[model samples]
Target: MSPYNALIGGVTATLLLGFAAQAQSDTLADIRERDVLSVGIKNDYPPYGYLDENNEIVGFEIELVRYIANELLGSPDKVELIPVVASNRIELLNSGRIDLIMATLGVTEERAQVIDFTEHYVSAAGASVLARQEARFDQWEQLEGQNVCGIQGAYYNRTLTDHYGIRLVNFTALPEAYRALQDNRCVAMVFDDMTLRQKLGEPGWEGYKIAVEPYEYLPMAGGVRKGDEAFLDAVNAAIVKAEGEDRLIDWEGEYDMPPSDHIAARAEAARAVAE
Candidate 1:
């Protein structure tokens, strides 16, 4: 055989071996071996996943996942919470650092290609406007040539700037964006309804309010690795059970406002299917 042919054969064999090893390294096997499900969450987003005055991680999603872990593993204590950021959530799941993600993950087709999503637990709609309650921006189109503040890697930036013809000013955190709105650095800050409500309700948030209305509703769901069918199925079953028992909505109500009509409708739908 030629020298080049031998080299090609060796490379092919190495690649095949790597693929075989990876195929056997399934998330189900890891979870069963450890007897603990690790969940990824955001430690900063208020009313969803954030540290409280006690310096403990506590929020709606955190509480809901505890109930899910209980139903799945027969004990709520058999889970670990790994705090994650928006940009790294998918990578953390793909790398097996966490078995599930319950952060405020927006479900999109692009994301679904790489991870499996449980039934959507929360829904959101995007809107943009300044903090001034008396501002008259009635639609997203009205923001042309106006600067809007958003998180550094927010999912809505492209749509707000490219599609909606608004100038975007990116911030590293939610608080920064809120501060920018308060300081009048930008004419508006685009964010989802749930988060906006929480921020606006914070003390000294009298200037900011939802504007331009909600253009679209985004379904938010938990995430698992792409090929973990068993884990995905278990998580979905747990979600359905929570919906049927009203546990998910109750948890959301505890930290955030009550579940919106859309969330209730989705929960009811999940219940119907589960029944």
Candidate 2:
């Protein structure tokens, strides 16, 4: 073979080998061998996954992932929680930065095309505005012309802006917007109901409240990289087993969320799928 042709062939073979190595990555076996269950979780969205007063990540999703770790590795202490946010969670998963994404990832057809999701675990949640009662927000119609804080990459920003003509002050992190809310930078923070509700219940947020209830609902699920059926199936089984054991109900209680009929029904269905 010509020298130029041989060099090209060698480069192509090396590139092919790299892709093959990534494609054949056995995440479950790696975790087992490393004795670490690395999971991506939200560190700002409270009651799902957030930092406590001690700066430790703690919440219902944290507990759920810990349960899965305990089941898989025979010890919850082996779990390593990697903090993630909305815009980059899927990218982090697909890029192999994290083994699984247990963040409060909403399910949608667009997102499913990019990454695989386990069976829906949490019931569908809706969007709402966390505003100070002084802002006097009573309905969605009242939001017109108001400046609302929102997280970057959230679907709600376009809806609030285009649909309602509201001005959006976008932030990369929820905590930044939360600070903006505290400082009166924005009239309200538009986000998922669960995170806002959790913040509202905390003692320091005395004057803030959800101005209006959620207008729409979306399912939430655990996310994993694509083309790994064995790992996906194992994670799904862990969730299903937990549902069958009523851990979802316990999680609701532990997280201080009001009893949810939708969550109960969803848990029942997940358990049925397990059977």
Candidate 3:
């Protein structure tokens, strides 16, 4: 190629890189100027982010996001909550529709390439099976040939099918999967352990039990567009402060979630750091 053409291409690439860097670094300042922190959240997954009895969105993650909003913007109300699901949350973040994602986002190596994660605040239980109380299966290996209800785009779907040999009946959302399980379409339903446990306690689930326990636990954190260092640091600071104040423990009780050792230890660590 001619030197002139090469020089023009190099200049164009440098300009694009500069524009990208400015986009990320300006998020915190933009939030301050707008006076609202926009966050992507789940409105169907309970105890984390879900619709309450009144159809209002409320959950542990919602509370945490509000706390961060208050810390950054001086009021919990100074935030916009945008509903997001597993498949599209990162896309929404990168497209600038949301400033941050707090939708039960599990930290993963693949995801890190597209977006940066805040300090992990929750150790989420991985896939567990929900089946009839009388169901005999108690191990993942036992369900090798069984059809299991699951949500599409769930991180462990491939793992369950490829490693454990379970045939997945994939749904776009949780309610459909749960309904399919009740309709006896699948022998069992598989999803996050915490959500399945919560379902077992609700009305109409008395006949069901967690037939198989989660084979793994994943660390959950908030997500931001890649290179958003200023916003990421601010969000992490608010999270640590909340932990040091035992707010997460209180939220666990409020949400009727079982206590977690991971949260408790993080609280202690945050307090120690503060001291």
- Cα lDDT tens digits, model 3, 54-162, are 9999999999999999999999999999998776677677768899999988776656656789989998777889999889999999999889999887878889999
Give TM-scores for every candidate, taking all chains together and pairing residue i with residue i: 0.71, 0.66, 0.71
Candidate topping lDDT: 3
Candidate 2's TM-score: 0.66
CA RMSD of each candidate after superposition: 9.0, 9.5, 8.5
Better of 2 and 3 by TM-score: 3
What TM-score does prediction 1 earn? 0.71
Rank by lDDT (best first): 3, 2, 1
Poorest lDDT segment (10 consecutive residues) of candidate 2: 1-10
